[model samples]
Target chain A: MSIQDEFSFINQIKPTTVHHEKTLITGIGDDAAVYIPSPNQSQIICTDTLVEEIHFTSQTMSPFQIGYKALAVNISDIAAMGGNPLYYLVSIAIPSSWSEQDLIEIYAGMSELANSHRVDLIGGDTVSSKDSLMITVTVIGETEEGRQLLRSHAKSGDVVFVTGTIGDSSAGLELLLSKGRHGTFNSNEDFLIKRHQYPNPQVKIGRFLSKLKRVSLNDISDGLASESNELAEASQVTITLNANLIPLSKELVSCDSEGAIEKALFGGEDFELVGTMSMDEWESIQQDGRLQNLIKIGTVSSGKPEVLLQLENELITLEKKGYNHFKK
Target chain B: MSIQDEFSFINQIKPTTVHHEKTLITGIGDDAAVYIPSPNQSQIICTDTLVEEIHFTSQTMSPFQIGYKALAVNISDIAAMGGNPLYYLVSIAIPSSWSEQDLIEIYAGMSELANSHRVDLIGGDTVSSKDSLMITVTVIGETEEGRQLLRSHAKSGDVVFVTGTIGDSSAGLELLLSKGRHGTFNSNEDFLIKRHQYPNPQVKIGRFLSKLKRVSLNDISDGLASESNELAEASQVTITLNANLIPLSKELVSCDSEGAIEKALFGGEDFELVGTMSMDEWESIQQDGRLQNLIKIGTVSSGKPEVLLQLENELITLEKKGYNHFKK
Candidate 1:
């Protein structure tokens, strides 16, 4: 379909109302979307872009998976900041060769995710591109006063924790590369593929954590090592992580035919939350029934900003950090 | 530079803070940028994307101009909603062929615009694309509660008006295509080229119109006919535009060597504001010396939503509407 026709197609399928956010004054069909923030709430904003080959490929991901993961990444950023996901704007660049069915499925995937999160897909722009498909999603979320988390708030002696599993996405991608989409897998292998294809951003846990005082947070998209370095740099502290304490799913552990710890440290695209909090704060949150599995894997120290990995009886500084865009 | 290194480059140059607004609780260096909206204010959000060959080519635009125009387009969306431009998130897909200098210049151009508007560039994600450069800018603006304009609120019998000239960008593109970059031009030709390269979003005018009690507003990105059609369709009223009343820049008038009226009617990317207001509202606005040039080009009448162009002695329905993405 032509760009104009694609817009009309989008309008036909676009959701008109969000589940509960009545603050949307006007959505879609206009110059921009207008919305009101709830009383005494702060807005948290973030954006992420996914390029065809750079972020995903047709072999490993369907059109629906592409759309689903594109929004998932940005929502992860909001989740890391301890905000409730509310609205998202998607900008897509479509090559002429892409079928109408492909575009429809992409939107359908996004619609499904939006419905699950109660986040409105308010407005977007569509344009033609000469190359592969590219999608950019910007998420707007809200947090009550003084509840938002920041990367620059990690305090000395604070404990570091990560939600869900680390390195599963990287392992999943590895398996997909070797086996292709049609490869048969048992439940363990299927879990890895699912983890890579559909990352669940920890929004609920993030919101719950935001209400507690004195916590620093970030999402691990660029691997745990890179994110930890960023947190240390932002907070002007050093993060010392115990490799043994890092959480690994049973599927990932069993699939560690290669360097699993290395993947956990430096591989990218894991949409899990990593954060730091004082022992008291962490203990208080642990009391909540929902956070029983929150893993304490490290501690923040008063030192030059950096990330240090502690293995059995030895501490090593990782020279090769997470995936760098310019590095081959 | 790798993506992480590119981020550091962005940080070295990104604006530290906006001029007056301190609602930014945190900027950049975070999982997501957090900001508090001012009391009784509604957030107006919009996004626009520009692809290399689709939006502009190196033959017609410089990296600086591309960066400037990308943000300018999003600002126009905010202006259309009658909101004050505040913060923006930029997600760019840079091809490997682009030099670090080219990327730096792009950010410099965006920084120039952001500084002028006092809009903060809080955060963004950068990724590698194998093909062309892509930019997606999402703008966040604010206005007093209930003050923002909407495309759906135009009342029947309201007067339709537009700010500034129309069709200059389309005409400018035509000139650039025929003349090439080195072609000589007088003041008028230069003005057209400038118009095409850098559109000044009507932020001040939009804010003024937004403060008014009753107004329906939109920006003319697609031609006058297309935008009018959208307004008519949105407000559920017929919009009758008088061709003679449509305002044209002096440069556009003299430069229209062929079918200037057609360009004014159906050309795209004018970046001017087209809105509708009641007679009393128009009269009150016209009384202000600042709004003396706001021209009444059309009227909203009770009928099926459509746009009718009044010519010399007859009315012509615009069958060839605005620029459609997919249509040739």
Candidate 2:
């Protein structure tokens, strides 16, 4: 089917299930989508784009995974801002060779995620590309009045924390490239692969944390080291991370890779939240079973803006930061 | 400069000038841009993307023009909804070969337009593309309660009107491909070239028209014939257009190209607003000197959804509808 036919099919199926918002004036099938804002709700918006070869290669990624991860990253951004995911606009460019079934499955992956998060697939544009498949998802979310989080809000004496484990995705990519040629994998390998393919955005945890006052937040997208430096620079405070205190899954350690800490520090696509809050707020969150594993990894200090890594009583300044797209 | 460094530069410059809404709690420099929507206002959002080879070539389009046109098309979508353009999120994928100055100029073009419209550049992600340059812009706007215009609202007797001339962009493309070999051009050619490069979205006019009741609207990005048919199909009405009544720029007509009318009907990238309203409403609009040239070229009727082109003596069914991205 052609692009127009595919759009018509998508319109008819309504694959995405959106939680009804009374303020939404219109949904789809127009030049733009319209909705009314709820009283005292602040709107938060962010956009992320995924390219074919640069982001993920077809050798290690499927069409469905691509769709899922594209939306997942944008949702992660919203979560970092302490906003509830509401609506998303997706723009996709497909090559001529892609089959209609591939496109449909891609949308299905996105719709499944959207349904779980209660985000409405409001409006987007589809076009033909000459080379690769690219998807850009723009998410619009809202938070209660004065409840939004920012990277610039971290203060001295706040304890830095992170949700879940890190560096699994980059390790999974490494495994796919080096050992996948043998075409066999064990159970732990499979788990790592799935972790890389699908990341769970900490929306629930982010919303829970937003209620607490005086917190700074950011998602670990470009790796812990890069995001930590960003948070420190934005807040004009120094952040020191205990490299050993950083949480690592047994699966990651058992994988037996050298430079495991470095990978966790500099790799990209973790999709986990890392932020700083006072000890009192952190202790209160620790009481809840849902956040029992939220690990305290460092402390915010009053100093020149920088990120320092501590290992075995020695402190080292970071030399190589996280992934930079334009750096050769 | 690296992508991160470039983003830092953008943050320092704050290229986008946003019309401050009292509800906006935060703008840029964070995980997301936050704004509180005013009470009784309906939010409108739309997104559009432009690719390297599919949209234009380096020979015909400067980096600044590419950036300008990329945002212009999205702004046009908002205008079609009769919503005021507010904040925009831009996602751009750049190849490694591009210079930092090229990237800066691109943002300058978008900034120039954003400042004029008072839309804030909130937050976006930049990635490295393997091959080409691709940019996506998403614009968020709002209208007063119940003032949003839609294509599905065209009534059976509503008259169809178009702002500005049609087919100039496509005509400019033909000129660029056929006769622009030596890079020398006449005054008329220059006018057509500029029309193709810089399209002025009718944002002010759309905001004005949104207050009127029972109006249908769409921007003529694909062409008059294509948008008219879209409006008709959406509203389930028959639209008939007078071929001679469709306005064409004198520069386009004097270019002496064959099939000028057909180009006006089937060519793409016009970026003009074509919609339907009552005759009374049209007359009232005509009384305003700003809207004196809003040409009425067609009428809506209750019939099988289709678009017909009327010449001097014959009414011909439109066979070549518009540019479909996936059509062979």
Candidate 3:
């Protein structure tokens, strides 16, 4: 885009109301954004990039969904850290082939989610790219002092739980890839597709869990197997997951029990909360009405770092086979 | 790069020490990095993207220079805002052709600069790209409350000043583009090429200027002509720059004066500070021995928002003709 076009695009997406006006001294239209941090709060920051073709195809995702998911993934990181996302910066490299309208739609998608969580768009860059479109989002968040959750805090005998269904997103992606974009889908297929296109980061659940004593948390970005392995390795413990207890969406299970289980084990991009907590803490969370969907999926044990799946009567080691960008 | 490769790269670049241990709660190897903000300080944040071929070609820059320039530009933004850069996040999209050693060297370039400023590498993402490499850096900084310098704070009777020399970078770029990368060069040519490859962001000068009574600041990333117009328009004033007074490096002036003037006016990526301050404040800063290189280039006047260049005997309106990514 021309400099004028870039400026116009920025003006279009410039936020009208900053959620934390007291803290946000400057948002857009400046060399850098300025904000006053809330005293005694720990700040959370993370960045994620979405490259066209590699992350999503136009056939499978609209520009709106692409933008929404880009920000959603960053927010999910903050959720995994037990923080509330407060501000975000987006740097988008656009190809000449894309229209301004498409860019605006993408920003709208991000704004919808940002407005919901009161996150403000602070500062970003808009530049032209030679070919594919790329969006990199950096989110800044905050939580109470010393309340940040981590992957290394899982203790032996902690009950492992996952919030909401797993494998739905990967199943959705599979359906989209197998059946062309224009194909009509049943209600189940539509739900699965939506799951893939629009992920809801578990911010509230993460915050609630962070308030509990002695909890370790991780977001299900990569598959359960990979994430479980990470948590186990970080905590230096062995995690045993019950195959039957792994949550699967009804739509995912309808395909085939074995296939759904496989997807749950190795498919990724679920944006769900998975963590280990003391049994008493888990029991206390179970009594909360909002956490009804929380599922007990495994147990942590003091042993050599590894992830194991309890399948039928056999104990099998789970491999880290989630999406690897350079694995080919 | 496989998942194993990505993990190994992360391990390689993982920071050994955090500069601000009290505020930095978490650094790398986490879902999101956590830090505590300095009490009562305003946080400054900005992001910039450097795209392959568009921003720099492999022919024009080494991978090390590419990485160094990527973070430097973002640091320049924070400097422009009168803040001390403390932490940064980098997201790099690599092509299959790049070796692991090249990536490591790129990180080393960034680490060299980061260590000088005591800035910490907080968090980032490394992913594979289909073709060209793309690097985006987001910097977080801070300044004392309400001390941010802005583009809109200049007033009538303010004297416009530029820190250090201008046009050297663009002149360097011209030499590189015209003579090609491997050609032998004299001392002047070497100096110009180094200026193009490595820019020093004026962080100290910016902080010094920010402490003044009132100053309007901008970094010359997009040429003085464009930046002058920005300050003029933002402050609702007219800026008149004296062509005779525009600072130029000896190497740049070794070329024709007209050509040097052209480069000084419209060429960019200097990362030098440009601002307007009250004549008294300017005079006070001039007395500082370290600020001897500061040049009085223009004056701000109350008039229609525009930029004008005062030539030998006439005043000509300067158009916004800086580098535009999509102008072609």
Candidate 4:
């Protein structure tokens, strides 16, 4: 469709999450979304940016996939905080050599994920570049009264828990890079490939945990150890992890123990929920089966973060863990 | 101040404005800006991107200025539609070349303007770029009920008007490129320099125009001729410009008439609002002393967009008379 048609079509994905803030009159489809004010809820805001070579390899993923992932990652952040995904603004820069089909695919991919997440694409910026492609997605989400979860909320003695499986994404990335072709892997491993390339966000789980049921929470995009470190840093509490308990993929079992453990601990883009719950609440959820692999790996502590690897009789500091975005 | 201190401290300015629609929940602050939604208002959305070596040269403007302009241009789109300036989301990709100090200054510039406009910065994406630097800003604004203007609203027999002057930015750019470090120009003329370096988005004027006072509206960023043509195409109406009525800079007056007219008609980045207004409303606004230089420049007609010259005495179709980001 034409550019005008695309915009008109986008207009239909207006948000349904009713707003209590009196200031915001129009959210997505205007020159600027209007906001009056609501004394009831204090707004929380954040922003991020991605570049062509830095965030993704245009060699591996399509522009559309890149576009979708850009927003998906941001949405994961809001979900980690137990917030409802409301709307998002996007900004893109493409090189002159790129085709119109490339742009169409990019927006189409973003629109696809955005529609599924029910987050409206409100507005953004597009400009031509002499360099590589760049995409940025900014999301707005809301938390109900007294339900917002933060990294700082993990009190000492709170049980550390994670939802769903981890290391699948990192493993998938290794497979994609090493194998090059998807067909070379076991077709059952197709699921792993998808996890790394197209991570499905757990918004519903986030919402569930936001009910003050969890003392703290974080999305596992930057691997478990990295996020755990973040929780510890923000909460100013020490965390000790039972490295033996951290979940790994069946594929990881075939791999070397050291490799499997490393991936589970530090390979990024897991998109799983790493959270903290009071000892009682953690027990309740484990019995509920609503969360498949929800396991208690350790506890909040007054001392520094430590990884107790029973097999090796080792205790490693949080800094010894793998790579993080801000880390050198 | 240290980079970290500047980054945190820049978030303090929060100016407030009275005019707004009903859909904005929270502007600025938090993880992302919130928008409410008013079904009566048709949301208009647009996005643009800027990259290093493509949009600006660091030699001409500081990184802070670049950051501020990146946001200001996006907001200008909202202004063009006559909408209220609300909060915006930002996405930035930086290369290793930049120091932490550089990032702080860049953000400081953006925060400075956002505070003045009462626009909150909600959320964005940041990633390492392997190549060039990029900054993208997405602004959301609102228009009142029954007042949202569109580029497709012009009708035959309507008078065309433009807010503020045009062509100053192109002139400023010319001076900047020359590296005339010691010379000074008019304070009013300096407006051109700032206009080129930091074009102002007319938020209040846009809010006023989107209130149905005008039949059609667009911002003059890609030159007047291009915008005129866009309105004509969108509205299915013809636009005719009176050669004498176009705004000219003092720098332009010193140049040959042909060169002056070239910049006046086709030079981009003026960031002025161009619109079609009914005869009566046009007269009233003209009589108001506050909007005096807001001049009548043309008229809508039944044919295609045509440029008229007193000497030629005939209509000439203006073809390829403006800047195209792709072509540039």
The residue-by-residue lDDT of candidate 1 on B1-328, one tens digit each, is 3244755666675775566456888877787888988888888999999999888888778889889999999999999999999999898999878777778778878888888999988878788888999999999999988988888879898999999888889988888888865688889988988998988999998988877778898898888888888888888999999988988888988977467778887888889999999988877766766565589998889998888999989998865377776674
User: Of models 1 and 2, which has the larger TM-score?
Assistant: 1
**Worst 10-residue lDDT window, candidate 1 chain B:** B1-10
DockQ of each: 0.74, 0.69, 0.71, 0.31
Q: Candidate 2, residues A281-324: lDDT per residue as tens digits? A: 87766776545457899999999999999988899986436876
Q: Worst lDDT window (10 residues) for model 2 chain B?
A: B1-10
Highest DockQ model number: 1
- Write the residue-wise lDDT of candidate 2 on B1-328 in tens digits: 2445645655654654457657567776777889888678888999988888888777778888888898899899999999888888888888877776787778888887888888877777778787778889999998888988899999888899988889888888777777652477898888888888888999987887888877899998887888888898889999999988999888888985566787788887888899999877777767865464478899999999999889989999875367766662
Stretches > 4 Å off in candidate 1: A1-4, A287-290, B1-4, B287-290
Highest lDDT, which number? 3
| Pairs clashing within candidate 3 | none
Instruction: Give the per-prediction TM-score of chain B.
Output: 0.95, 0.93, 0.96, 0.84
Sort by lDDT, best first: what order?
Answer: 3, 1, 2, 4
Per residue, candidate 4 scores C-alpha lDDT tens digits across A291-319 of 55567777887765443333348776755
Residue-level error in angstroms, candidate 3, position A66: 0.4
iRMSD of all candidate structures:
1.7, 1.8, 1.6, 5.6
Worst 10 residues of 3 chain B by lDDT: B1-10
Q: Each model's C-alpha lDDT?
A: 0.85, 0.83, 0.88, 0.67
Pairs clashing within candidate 2: none
Q: Is candidate 1 or candidate 4 better by TM-score?
A: 1
